[model samples]
Target: MADEVKLHGLAGSPFVCRVKIALKVKDIKYDFVVEDLINKSADLVKYNPVYKKVPVLVHNGNPISESLVIVEYIDDVWKGVSILPHDAYEKARVRFWAKVVDDKCLPALFKAIGSHAQEQAVAEAHEQLQFLENELKVKGSKFFGGDSINLVDISATFIAYWVGAAEEALRITLVTKDKFPKLKEWSDNYINCQAVKDVLPPREVLVGFFKSRFGKA
Candidate 1:
């Protein structure tokens, strides 16, 4: 029998989008179970008891939680397209950058959008984004993964896609071309990629969601 793969996720979630993009890149066929996060499905809780989150990847009978973890698990199990680098150093570098995106960039972005002290939070987000801008300049590639999308690019999906929606909804731009030229270019390249474009949530949907969630600023 073919391997059974199921992704429990919420619509318009960047984390879930990462897994979808990886699956598309590898041509892996799977079922997507859209979960209503507020209601908290039993299967989602059962699959990921600790976090009880959306974006749980259940393969055959086993389950994998966390977006990045599930993405790495997909890369490890699949063949054909490679989501991570072959060299040990390069692989480590990619992992390091991915961590920065999650640990540094993501939190800063959330603060910029949601915090009461908007000015300070936005400044912090810009500081974090500068790191990515410099990394892109140094790499001198269309993506962090050189010619193709990889774990780093997938991990930074939120910055490329969701940020735009957040900016639109909030009427405050955090990643402008003037402040982050290379990152702006990279975002253009990323969202336009066939694989990524195919899997991304609609911009309007995301914008509306953000507007409803955070309210207009």
Candidate 2:
């Protein structure tokens, strides 16, 4: 089998973006195969038999699912500018924050934003944002990993891209100076980075679409 890397994922998904960011940071070239997640292709199922999710990374015919796992795999296989920390404890810490984003944070944001009741959605979103802000403070880092974007940054960046759409869909603002200053500043800087800015979906389009569909409005 050829030692080639290929990514099968949806274009607009934050999960896929995570994989893209890792690949870009490492300067690892790969093939891109966009998939319709709603109507998953047979190839996607073959690659990821369980979840059949997007952001599946195929490496020399071996398949890996989950964006974070894919990222670790990429980092290990093609080490360049190392994204994960050298210390084991620090690596675990980065992974811990990543888990928070993957398990608690991302799901809550999506659910709260996708809820039909505007008030409830906004309330939940606010609560989650507060928790997130506290985490940022406790960590005392520019990102979850600090300084340069790391695994924690890669993990968080996935859902951070969708805040605009979430706010519009739920008719509430999560990022504000009074509320999440560090997060807001970090988000602005993160998005404005040439890698993210040039590749992200149009904000207006995301808002309009999610506002209609996810909001059920």
Candidate 3:
């Protein structure tokens, strides 16, 4: 199928998972190509020459790199319920949250997982999560965009699954129910939603992998 859509991604990557969820939501069928990040496939390198990363979207042979960029491209091309809001201001807000997920939340999360200054890293991650909690409070929305998932929710897909895995792997909890009730509720909702549940990597496997990669806290 030369004209079929294809995706290059790595297993258990939340960035990649974002695309999967969006494609499922949009009802767009795509061929998924799992890449070996370590070895780096020729096609993966060739298609995404700049970043040389996975989660590349090949639509009828045209390649698009970066997960969020690919997701937006998907939304634009497909005809369905949009991942972004229709209103100009609302769309900007969604993009803002998405940027926060990529620039702040994810970096803080990885820092908590892999940094030597464990306590400081955890505190920093907590701060970022708290910021998101505030956003939810201000919007008074169940999920990032509302009752249904949207681009902001998709952008923070890691929080839905990988955060718990990282917590179990490290023996430290960042998203305790007490500290982040609304955030925790949102996380539960996001993971249990039909669109997200099937695509999530098993928590046990994620925990094991992270445990081996980062070792016990």
Candidate 4:
């Protein structure tokens, strides 16, 4: 079987970036095919027949969809970077947090992003941050992975970067040290990691994109 891998995604999408970041961390080499989600390609539709989403990872013509699922597939295939813990229980814990990111966090933030009213959206955005603060009460533990960047951290890319970008785009404050200190700390640490830092789309770029998106909604 051919060892070649390819990823079809766009530049600013957090979901697409998740797969890219995972590939980079795993030190896996793959071709990047930028897709116009508004006008998707036949290949994307062909591979991801269910959702027709970008961020479809094609490993030697074998396609995988969904950002988190792609990340897990990459981790399993690369078997080098160890994005998830080796221990079964710890791995379950990490995956659990990853699901928290997908199920609890991303949807809230997405609603905040494409909301018609910026004011209420900003308020809802803060609610998501509040949940993170409550969950991370273990104190002093860094990152969602509790001291190291893990699958959850990558999965929560929307919450991490898009939250800040959405707040700025909306001209509102969401993450504050006074309320979500530990989460604030985690956000700070998360952005600085080389893996994340290098991959983050420019804030101004995101701001422009989100501003237009919010305005259009």
Best by TM-score: 1
As a TM-score, model 2 comes out at 0.88
Tens digit of per-residue lDDT, candidate 3, span 48-98: 999999799999889999999998998898978789999999999999999
Ordered from best to worst lDDT, the candidate numbers read 1, 3, 4, 2
Candidate 4: tens digits of C-alpha lDDT, residues 42-96: 9999999999988899998899999989988888888776788889998898888
lDDT of 2 by residue, 69-129 (tens): 9989888988677889999998988888788777777777677666643567656666766
Candidate 1's C-alpha runs over 4 A off are none
Worst 10 residues of 2 by lDDT: 113-122
Report each candidate's C-alpha RMSD, comma-separated, in the order given: 1.3, 2.3, 1.7, 2.2
**lDDT comparing candidate 1 with the true structure:** 0.92
Pick the winner on TM-score between candidates 1 and 3: 1
Query: How high is each candidate's TM-score?
Result: 0.97, 0.88, 0.95, 0.90
Steric clash pairs (candidate 2): none
Candidate 2 stretches greater than 4 Å from native:
1-3, 215-217
How many clashing residue pairs, candidate 4? Answer: 0
- Which residues of candidate 3, in runs, are more than 4 Å off? 1-3
Better of 3 and 4 by lDDT: 3
